[model samples]
Target: MHRILVVDDEEAIRKNIERLLSLEGYEVATAPNGQHGLVIARSMLPDIIITDINMPGMDGFAMLDAIRHHPELDRAIVIMLTAADERDSMRRGMRLGADDYLTKPFRREELLDAINSQLKKLARFNREKDNAVAKATALTEEKTREHFREQFAGSSFPASQFSGYTPDGSSGFGVSLPPESSSTQTLQATVMFADIRNFTTMAERLSAAELAALLGRYFELACRPVVAFGGTHLKMLGDGLLALFEEDAQPQEDALSHAQRALAASVGIQDAVGSFKQWVQEQYGQRGLPSFSVGIGLHSGEVTLSRLGGMDSPEVTALGDSVNIASRLQAAGKELGWLVVASIDTAQLAGECLRHGRQELVSLRGREKPVAACEVLGISAVPSLQQTHPPFKYDPASLQAAAVQNSEMTARAAKEALKESLWSLQSGSFQSMQQSFRGYQIIRKLGEGGMSDVYLAFSAAQKSEVVLKVLRTSLSNDAEMLRRFIQEYAVLANLTHHHVSRIYDQGFTDDYAYIAMEYLSGGTLKEEIRGRGTPGNSFTGSPAQVHGRVIDLLRQITSALNAIHKLGLVYRDLKPDNLMFRSEGGELVLVDFGIVKNVGEHTVGLMPERLVSTEHGQVIGTPYYVSPEQATGQEVTHRSDFYSLGVMLYEMLTGSRPYKGDSLNELLARHLHAEIPRLPPEHAIFQMLLDSLMAKQAIDRPADAMGIWRGLDILANKTGSLPKARID
Candidate 1:
């Protein structure tokens, strides 16, 4: 019987395979790891070996090299067993002279067929050995007369010389081998690295066994794609895999294809790991793993292929700083939030095969020269066929062209068009307004404010509705206002608060400018109060209903203000007009930022032509919401905004301003010293909050928005849940 060996870490799989193969009348032996498997293969000189690719010590790749050098085992067929579904891995196995590869989750019949096929091939080879030797000798005798044939020499690699070392680190090899006296070989190779962005934290979360499992699966996922593009995995780097390419591969196999494969592997790793975590979550909720992000870097260069270390314990390695830099660049991508960064060399080698963006000079450690890299756009080469590809769009150029066209069209339409423009004399210029949005389907006009008109636009890009605010043209030339607007909008964009409106897009137009914001489907609190009026002649009715709604609105507004304050910004105008009610969940979202400013007071920087008006009037704010100090033209801080919120709450409850006037001068006079009437005892927490908010001195108000929100929360809870009571 021909001898066959099976190596696997799993005892059950090893035993089951042994029994199944023995039933077919072939002698079989099993080992758990690379070290033991090599020993058994050497002693037994098995006719064939089947082993798992992933193991604790000296994986299948390492064992293949050990068998390759054995004089007796060199002819042995090796079949790699893996659970991975990547085709690249199968090609890699074949490149290493593996007789065949079998993926796990296999059928019984498939295993039997693979074994029979290999055994039959071995039998056929044996049958031809005598005839082949005779023919070869006859040919050699004829060639012996030739000078080229006579001078040719052959070298032998023996397994006995490598018997001293073990795959496990139990023993060390004491001898080293002399370098091979062979001419250097040049190969076009693509080197790739797939690394975990936050591997340290990931390791902390998983046990040693779990980590090993994750690494195995990760390597399995990464190796297949590399192999598919005619690349071979060199080794594992903790949370990464190193893959190399060879010269004899197809011409179509270039650095670009390999880089794309690396990126794809990175993305696939996330999906596979995510699925695994999801499974764990379903089985054991709290024990589920955390989400992971991956980054990849690829470069191509000349790699010297050589055997390093002692002959008895040599490792297959490609040494060069290019590989190290590629690895580090992958790590650097984590900071840049890029999935893949390809070096300039890789870009050139890959040429048309590489789909990439503009080049960027990346700073690397220990290197004086900054590396020029590009974001790998995708895997496929740009076909000579396509006239224009969507992803290859010139965003800036298109936008500029569109702006110019829109300007010409706007001017033409204004003169010839019959539709009355939204802007009037009071609305000023259409400073930040968008005219033609190709894909945005305008649902309807949401509301019109003093400075801008907002519409509920369904965005095809976001696949959800958004509020597109078209600003009035009057404020466009106010550079000071524009500067403040830009700075405040930028701060708001970076700030992700649950209670605030998320600013998505902002830009300028020739005659207009626009800001696309999150669209809240509900009506404003102002509209809701008008619909759900208090019982006859009352704006503040049942204490339970009225107090609960007032407290809810207060809590939401305060929460939003607190977030803005944390970011060193103060919303000078805080009232119901700026808050929207989300119909879906009754959640309050703070919107509108036409009058926001920095937290601390500062002198306004005037332009050269506008320096004449240095005297500032009562700063622009809603009459009722303006604090006493604000009305007196005094400096304002975050505390001043709290006072406005208090007035806003009072108006929401009573459907009328706490104080009002027909003229600006009269309004400022009343706001500076007028006493806020106390709410009846039945108003519950409203009176206490109002006392603090309407405090004559800014310091007398609550410390911050949080204090106000917290107090409101207590009142809200005391109102007995207030189910079905919409705060709006």
Candidate 2:
């Protein structure tokens, strides 16, 4: 019988493999980890061994080395179980004579096929061994050595002796000697450090092999832009990487050139990371794996480059204040919630090519005084190389041509066109106010925010007016902002409701990013409320007409909230400004979804409080309409929407919010401690319904939107205030 040994620190994985192999008629044995697997292998002399790369004691790499050197088990067929990102471990295993490997979460067919393939190779090797030995005896020692080298030349393992030190930090072999340095040189360079944010906390939820896979993929994606923008990748420092862009010595490239390349590389790296995260969500998001962010820092100065350590373990690295400053900048990025940050020197040297945010004075370690720094947005214009395929040779002539094409009007254009182009090119903002996004033409500016701007636009395809939400110029390259802006489309696209504003189209252009949505010309509820002056004094209609109109509006609002709740979404920022009336239909629609949250998703970074409060003392949502739980930094649910709705209803009827205070703190305190405002005795039923909706405790409120709507309908009927025409 063929005996196979399965080893993994995870009991479920070990047992699962053992069961699978047993079902295939092989005698299977299981071990908790690599160390235990070695003991079993020595006794059982298993025909095959399948081991995990990451274990508690001896990792798969260390154990494979041991097995290859052992007298009895040296010929055993070994298969490594690794995660997709653990390419380094897989390569090392190949060098140590492992026959095959399977990525984690493998299918039964894949696992079985890998095993059978290795078994077939073993059978072929056994048959050829005697003939190979006979032929070896006829050759010289040098010839035999050369033959062996040629046989395994395709293997990716480094040409170093295999060390048996356990990767899991267990007591095994002593430390190995460091690799020797071969050469060193001094040069001017811009250094950058990109570190994964909150990696330590995120690591707690992932398996070792899983984490290895994630990090490996992240490094691969992060390193591409570095090389693409002419930066040399130095080394990976655990959850981060070190890269340098050196000034060309022959042409005597200036400091500005190095800084520009480094900054551009940083932008590319940030974009690539964002794309990777989105790809992961599209591919493996259903598996409940967490997503993360990266922080990058850039600095330019003189640095020493050297080949460090022994010949067997050589590492090319940079050493100087530039490297130190770069690393500190990465840390500052994390602290300040910025994706990319750079020293003032780097920013100044980058010049017009890069856009930057407000400058700040930051204290760096090992420096006597605080240094000036700024947040880097990205390259101001489309790169010339972007239009070509790689071996992206930098051609100055091509860049000049492209620059002229971008900065000057077309040859067929009039003199006015040339003048307009000059004005736009000279202005700090890359695009004019009447810029076009995709097929939508900007008509006028509606409003602006810290991160983005809203514009009134006309969509030729839709043949209707649409709202274009464009990201601000300074934040165009921000990964987090771009992500949130994209997420708004994703959220709205999935939701098909009459009362929810629809997204017609969304995309990014060379100059800006934007989302086109259905336009509402009837103005916001805030404007309507303001137009009415004081609530009770503004209406001159009969009491029944006023009450019936109020009921109709409440029904529409509640029905919209119900539709949102059914999809497990909460409009955290529900307020008058977000409610708008359609021009053609006059139906109220939930307009802004900037802070919408998916129930149970624990996203990180700014605006995370929109979803649910993961930590104390962090609050989100508008103060006047915020729920009690939300004000206290507690988990919010659909009930929170009800509280906001109740506050809105109170304002609609009374012309003011139920709770009032001189400061935001006092307002929040009122929500938590203030008594419920009493209504007029004549309108007792409506007052009772309002009191129920505004209950302090979530448990005391109506169960859902449907329940509240039904309750309000019944109240309207009882009071003979039901409208002749229902909005729904």
User: Would you give me the overall lDDT of model 2?
Assistant: 0.64
Candidate 2 per-residue lDDT, tens place, 1-728, comes to 35699989998777667655653446689988788899888767777999988898898888899999985577688999888998888888899998899997898778878877676454333323322322222222223223323432333222211111111111111111223434556878888888776453233333445555566567666766675666653344445566677776653322237777788778888888878898667654443334567899888888775544434433334566777788877765543457899998888778888887656566554565667888787777534544321222333342232222211211112223323433443353242345766678888889764346789988999998999898632212234455556557666776678888998876544235678899899787776666554454322255555566567777878877877777677777788888888862377888767666777444322233333223454466777888999888787888898888888877776667889765456788899888877765544557877888889999998998878878877878876865432334
Cα error, residue 61 of model 2, in Å, equals 63
User: Across residues 356-470, which tens digit of lDDT does each residue of candidate 1 receive?
Assistant: 6645566664566678887776645433212221111222332232223222322232222111221121144222223345457777777654344678898887899988876
* Candidate of highest TM-score: 2
Off by over 4 Å in 2: 1-431, 473-479, 533-540, 600-615, 681-683, 721-728
Write down the RMSD of all candidates, one decimal each.
32.0, 26.1
